[model samples]
Target: MNTRTLIASALALGFLAACSKPEPVVEAPRPVVVFTLASAQVAPAALYTGEVRARYESDLAFRIGGKIVERRVDVGAVVKPGQLLARLDPADAGLNAEAARAQLAAAENEFAYARAEVLRYRDLVAKNFVSRSVLDAKETAFRSATARVEQARAQASVAGRQAGYTSLLADQPGVITAVGAEVGQVVKDSAVVMKLARDGEREVLIAVPESRIGELKKAGRVEVRLWTQPDVALAGRVREIAPSADAATRTYAVRVSIVDPLPALQLGMTANVVLADAAASAGGLLVPITAVFEHGGASAVWVMQAEGELVKPVLRKVTVRQYREDGALISAGLTAGETIAAAGVNKIIAGQALRPVAPARPAAAPMAVRPGAAS
Candidate 1:
């Protein structure tokens, strides 16, 4: 092998290698579920079930304890002022009044006798037939008898008032909503015998859960609608909210005052209450839950950016306002109309080429096949 021959062989080998080129390396783009960012449609208000009630409902009870002898009113009965609703047994009250009157009469007779004796004693004292001490004793007896007469009169007045209480009279005009006592039933003093709902000013009562109590406090507008009259909506305001949650249901009781209630609204009617906030329902963007991934100890998503004819994944950090069952509410770091990888976000990397496929649809359920059907 001379120098010229070796150089000629190396040149021939290099020419052959240059003429036969190596196969080109082509990278296939990865398929990914894509999603577009857009403003989420939020509900204008939250709904709660409620019941219509009167603004003033009171329990009617007997002032004195006795067995009921008469019940003139029943549930749903309309009553007027001073109208008799019920009556207790008058035997006891009448007897007490009679006893008081008899005692008063006896006191008056004793007073008359004392007055006569005092006069006689005075005459005797003037004539020197009786001592001055005897006249003084007679005057004292007259004064004591007069005091007894006055005391008996007061007792008679109380007894008369008690007899009037035996008859239950309606203090106000209202409709009876409940009846707790009937004829022949014995009731104690102050025990509720009936329920009356005054015919004015209606309200809706609803229960709210503790989780959405903050939204209730910030409610901008409230609306109420009766179940029977769904088209007619009444303006309402939050009149009261329970300070604490209920022990059994663990919900707060809310009362809404209807501004101008219609005639159709009756007691115990079912209704619906809605709470709305215009400010809070705007400017939120939702993305698929799978699109969000943790990147560098922060929440991020793989945003798709067009690189000429190919789409590339770009890691972008975003501020997640809330994570919902359907998606994550993105408050920042993403603009409307932008596209992102909806699934397989963990496998995505910056500058990675992507195919940008539409989101995968949920799999259809298999059709039921009966025995001895098609093979």
Candidate 2:
């Protein structure tokens, strides 16, 4: 054990210790979340925003002009057929009717006196006591009296109708939606006094783009969801499609009749309509909108694939039929039960190996709030 030997050993030990400091642990790549294409028997749909409206709305008007003396109903008041809704002052009408009746009675008495005079004249003429000119004059007088009586009767009938016109009545059962006049307000002939929404049926009216109108008509049926009650879906049929497009919007009007009574649904409520076709049901796939990517004026998606000892992603082209808030409907270049990257899609490229990731669970549906109930 010499001093030289000890110094050499100590230097060698120090060199080994410096060179062999434990290597830092290498970390594995972070895992990505992806969704697998699923084969869901979804009823294909096309959604539209619309409004609930009554099937028939009637505007009630006065047949004759007069000051409104009374209004018997207000907005939201329920009325039945032939129910009195309002009335004008009948004073003038009553006076007119009385005048016509008095004139008619006087004309009847005159007619009776004329008939007796003609008979007396005829008997005198037969006895040669009266001249032929006098008999002729008596006959003419009787005919004129009869004509006056007929004219009086017609005047009486006109007066009766005018009196009846003072009272306004409902022609059908309905809810009063509006009152256009107030008490003491002078209204013109045929002026609208009230608005009524008729019973029996209700409908949803929507405006759809002209380009989509043809497809909608071909689809045939749609599902309606009220904005107030998103969870409750009601069935509707395509009742009408306007032939002309609106000048400003370039969209056509579509009316959908609600098949069943939705008591909770009311007039003026907003609605969402879903339109579907057979092609959508048979061969299309729906994916979250975020998963779709654009490239060279075409739509593409990042799909996860397997590679030896590594996980990567590849971009594949697809055809987008339509876009939805939560997802998109793909017409081509994708299949059910295949995995695709939903997030971090931009970082992926063609033919890259990728490890499959779990799809995100769908969000829970919100609870429905009934009308007049606390939200």
lDDT of 2: 0.80
Candidate 1 positional error at 240, Å: 2.7
Residue-level lDDT tens digits of model 2 in 68-150: 99999999898999999999988988899999999999999999999999999999999999899999999999999999999
Model 1 C-alpha lDDT per residue in residues 1-375, reported as the tens digit of each score: 899999999999999999997999998888888877643333434468888887889999988889999999888898998999999998898889999999999999999999999999999999999899999999999999999999999999888888898998888888999999989999998999999998778888898888678877876558898889987888988888899999999999988899988877788999988675332244346677788988889999988998766689888999876664345766678877788888888888788878878755842111111223221
Best TM-score among the predictions, by candidate number? 2
Provide the overall lDDT of each model, using Cα atoms, as 2-decimal numbers.
Answer: 0.81, 0.80
Worst 10 residues of 1 by lDDT: 363-372
